[model samples]
Target chain A: MSIDWQPFLLTLQLALATTLILFVIGIPLAAFLAFTRFRFKAIPEAIIGLPLVLPPSVLGFYLLLLLSPASVFGHWLDTWFNVRLLFTFWGLVAGSVIYSLPFMVQPVQAGLQSLPLSLRHASYTLGKSRWQTFIHVLLPNIKPSLITGIVLSFAHTIGEFGLVLMIGGNLPGKTQTASIAIYDEVESLNYATAHVYAAILLLFSFAILLLVYSIRKKLQGSITGL
Target chain B: MIRINITKQLRLAHENTQLSIGTTIPSNTITAIYGPSGAGKTTLLKILAGLVQPEQGAVEVNGRIWLDTARRVCLPPQQRSIGFVFQEYALFPHMTVQQNLQFAAGKNGDKSYIDKLLHLVKMEAFIHAKPSQLSGGQQQRIALIRALVRKPQLLLLDEPLSALDDAMRHELRTELYHIQQQLQITTLLVSHDISEVYTLASNLIHLEHGKVVFQGEPQQLFGAASLSSTLQLTGEVLQVIPDGAIYTVEVLTGKNIIRVTAGEHDIAKLQTGDKVCLFVKAYTIALKKMNG
Candidate 1:
């Protein structure tokens, strides 16, 4: 049996897009949650962190109901621009973001938490605004952790199956990612094709993980002058 | 030309905690806040630096209102032109020593000023080293100069030398005193070490449980009844038990045993038969008659 490479390319593209979007949204959100003391903070943190423990199907079900026509949010989205987020690439992206929420946040939180509070205080007392401190002092320090989160989220999104199945329904050329394609091949009794994708995915994930750990090691070494 | 005036009342019924800031740190003087832990030395420094908000208080630097809590006008710490060094030597661990100074300086491509700062701190050799890579003393130096790199209206150091060795700390204290004089930046330092106050402080603010017990010069503080009583004693070295964190220097005088915290240098020179004078405060003298 020959290998079909379309799904592989689509999966890589989907993973890259999800990683980029999560980076854009996750870093600042994590930074804020890790640093600030605000009223109702626990609520947003609980909501953001809800997906970490909830089964992918449960989160997917809620998202589905949320986007359904009967829901007020769905009506607002439609009224706003007739936007439908049930079975599109955007829907998949949305589901992946939620599914990989902890992957993005845990490392960032750990990064920020491990930072000495004195750094921020030093910057604050130097008459540098909170924004300036974050950009200049905080970001450089947490770069390794940020990279770890991005890489983990990207790889984990690539491997996500439950959320994609619930929200995307294996729609090829639209929402069907590599994991779905592999599942489809397995269900169709094409063991050889399944093995090809599975082997490729395994090798790719290992490669990514190796690359991440190596980079992280170098950062730690340089940081501590080892 | 730095002035601070604030009054904070903390009546816990079980424990009373009231803080009043009615003092002006003289220009170009390193005013030391000397007190035990939890005596609000850091709090006083924070209040002066505009990092803390008092219920009803105010702070004036150079005759400008930095915080007027009663009038409901308080500037955030970021807007206050003050240099601050935290106790933990909060240098950016991810940034190189050079980058840390440059970040504090807020320069785009200018490296000359950073070089000068590194030289000022005697850390020019470790410009490329990260904070984690540097020693505690080195980090403290970087932290000090990092605050000074901005050239603010006032400099505040919170137990900066507590985490350093004796030689480094003593050397840096001299360096800081000299720098504070040369730069003419009014400085405030918080420490529990009486020796540090003696060495670096021209004026002393002794805090006891969040209230100012004595606000005067170190010479006056040593002469005060409260400080002198607890700190003055007469004894000799009985035993030196090293517990790693600090050596318990037991001084024996007649039937009385006086134990005090001393550094390795003092501990090394002590012997069982050596007669010595222990000048401890009365409050610190625990009367138990060990030989009864």
Candidate 2:
């Protein structure tokens, strides 16, 4: 009769791991897409955003094939590192990162683009290296956007269902995230557990969104005080 | 010394124009680049800072080669030891005044130097204030010192005080001169304000239509008298009499005829009835008395 808390804890772990990985990869990608000019820029931009419009099942199907041990990428990983991604926790994380890529990239890239060109020019004229300028000047100036990207990516990864279901195969205590656990309860007509899982998710998501908005407000207030 | 010979094409008002500038600015002096809006003054500054590449040019600063098109050498702005105060006062909005100075001080620079610079502009109290919290004039003062914190070999200022009110502009103009003299940093200023140019520049380079119209001492280019001169008048030359190497020219002002003596080179261009502006220093103009 008691609710199994393992699914809920696993969900938070996956979300945290995916968000941290995105933070490391997203900032540089967003900077490159925001600042540089290239012939095929739109192609990569669209690919990053494909998860937003493509159905979760469709993306999950492709990732399943791509991460299967028989595939070249998956085979290389297994042979070289003795690793496997199929039906595993890391596989769920990989799925979550790809599905949440655009959520992390868009806000950060927009923030970087909106900054004044003179800021970069001034930094360069002062003899600062590109890395130094990005860290000291650009990153601090885009705090609000950085927070938005992180929050959205974390929340989106937590709420994901179809990608994890297909890639991780819904194994209990391993890939049975809160979303999948709730689905299983509903299918078996376990109304009480379903209600509990759904309520926790709704409240947690609302609290995260509220935190994001309040932080944004505080940042704006400090900007005006300056 | 800064020697520049560069050419770049610019699009102005939908017309193509070439900017060809060649000049050598002496060391330890302030040289003002005075020109109209579309005269390529800012472009020249960008080239000097290594922000813009010239199609065919060579820039030599203090015996170092910055840009040489023939040699296929062009150093990036980060490698050039120069300071540039952008027209917009490009202060980092996120950083406080002190943080801004520390950012420019670089890792090897002296951190205490920031306090000295802030003291010079009387901005010590606002060291913790962000740029957005300060007025336009205040931001400009920070921008100037931020550039100087590096002790740059060359300081390039593009209308640094243009955004300030007239009173502030006038006040900063004097402070700017004193600071330039105290540091003796080679400076290149681009401004449209004639008075500002006259007050600060030891040398003036006038640009028009992307060409150098005149390059000389400030007074010589303006045809204006020096501060030491007391009598200046616009008059018509009535006659020129030869007296050895000197010529006595008769100039008729409003009510009287004044005979001014000048060297033969000065009088050679003066013809009868030609309008001219005359400058006579107070000590040079003698007072005469008639028997009464």
Candidate 3:
């Protein structure tokens, strides 16, 4: 039996895109959460943490309603930007980003919080701007956390099932992620294809986790040793 | 001269303390902010550096207005031209000794000036070493030079030598004294050690419960108390050993830890870590000039 590679490639592309976007947005958000003393900080914190506990389907349902053409937001997007999110690959990315946000943010936020306040203060006193300090001083010191956030976001996006199923219906090459393809194959009694996909995913996830653990161990050892 | 008139409300662990300080410090001199714990010493330093904001105040450093609450003008730390050495040294662990100074020296920082600073501290040998690889004393020296690399108008040190052992503290204290003199930059040092204040500071601002209780020469605050004695030393009580009716109290003063004989009343009020002043009558001490 010949296997189709389209879904796997699409899944990799979606995961890469999602992880990149999250990395760009997540650092500033995590820094804000870690450093801000706003009175209503808990509100934003709770919102970011919602994905960690909420079932993927619950988030997917709201995202579906929010992005569907029947909704005002969806219509606004379709009209102004001429962008259609529903049942699209980008829609799958949007959903995965939201679903995996806490995974990226929590580790990064914890890392920022764990750093000594003096590091930032020292940089500031030495004529470094806040942006400079954040980029040069703060970010370099929290490498492990950054690695963890990136890896977790990538792996979580790759393993996505329920959210992808909801927002990005199984539409062949356009929207069918590897997990979705696996589901489709199993439903069609294609056990061999399903087994192949499942085994690949299992091995890939194991490798990613192993890489994360090893890198984290090395980083932690160096940090403490220093 | 630096003129500071500021008042801030501080919420400490046990109580709400108000820090009200108004003092003039001599320019280009090491002025020690001597105070007990919870005296808002570090906070005052931070305020001058523009790191901490005062509720109401004006800080004029060498005729430059750094902060004016009424005018709603407060220079950010980056614009203040100040170098602050934290108590913990706060050297960047990721950067080597050279890089830490380079980062402080800024985009247009002179390479020769950085080299001069490293050489001045005798840290040229460890230029490529990261902060983690160096000992606490080495890191402290790097931190001190890093603050000075910018040639800041004001230098603030928050107990820079507090983390070092006695021997290292003494050695660095002397090094810091020479560096300050050579640079002639205005410096504000926060120190709880009376001996440290006595040895390094030319001017003293004594704070108690966040208020400037005294402002004058270190000699005026610590020296004037014993006019009859030629040598006066202050130290913290390390241990109190009793033998017969007299008590032998070990006091850590400057570079030497000497045991003093105390009477019953003296031993009664004394505790470990209590600051004590020792007045040695001129006859009991010998003085000699060493040939260079």
Candidate whose lDDT is highest: 3
Error (Å) of candidate 1 at residue B25 is: 2.7
Misplaced by over 4 Å in model 2 are A224-226, B221-292
Docking class of 3: medium
Tens-digit per-residue lDDT, A1-226, candidate 1: 6677777887888788889888888888898889778977788788887877888888888888888767999889888988888888888888888788778887898898898877777788877888888888787778789999999999989998888888788888888888999899899998888888899999999999999999999987766568
Q: Give the TM-score of candidate 2.
A: 0.84
True contacts kept of each: 0.91, 0.76, 0.84
The ten-residue window of minimal lDDT in model 2 chain B covers: B221-230
Q: Can you tell me the CAPRI class of model 2?
A: acceptable
Tell me the tens digit of each residue's lDDT in model 2 across B1-292: 9999999997898677899999999988899999989999999999999888878999999999999999999999999989999889989888888889988987777878888888888999998998889988889999999999999999999989898988889988998898899899999999998889989999999998888999998888765554455677878999999988788999998758989888978887789999988765677666699674
lDDT per residue for candidate 1 within B1-292, as digits (tens), equals 7677777765554776777767777777888998877677887888777767777877888889988866789888888888899888888776788777777777553567667767777788988887877788888888888888877888899999988888888888888887877787888899998778988888888888776788888988665554445555456677888988788888886567777788888778788878786653355566676462
TM-score of chain A of 2: 0.97
Candidate 3 chain A, poorest ten consecutive residues by summed lDDT:
A217-226
Note the Cα lDDT for every prediction shown. 0.82, 0.91, 0.92
Model 2 / residue B53 / CA error / Å: 2.2
The number of the candidate with the highest DockQ is: 1
Q: What DockQ does predicted model 1 obtain? A: 0.72
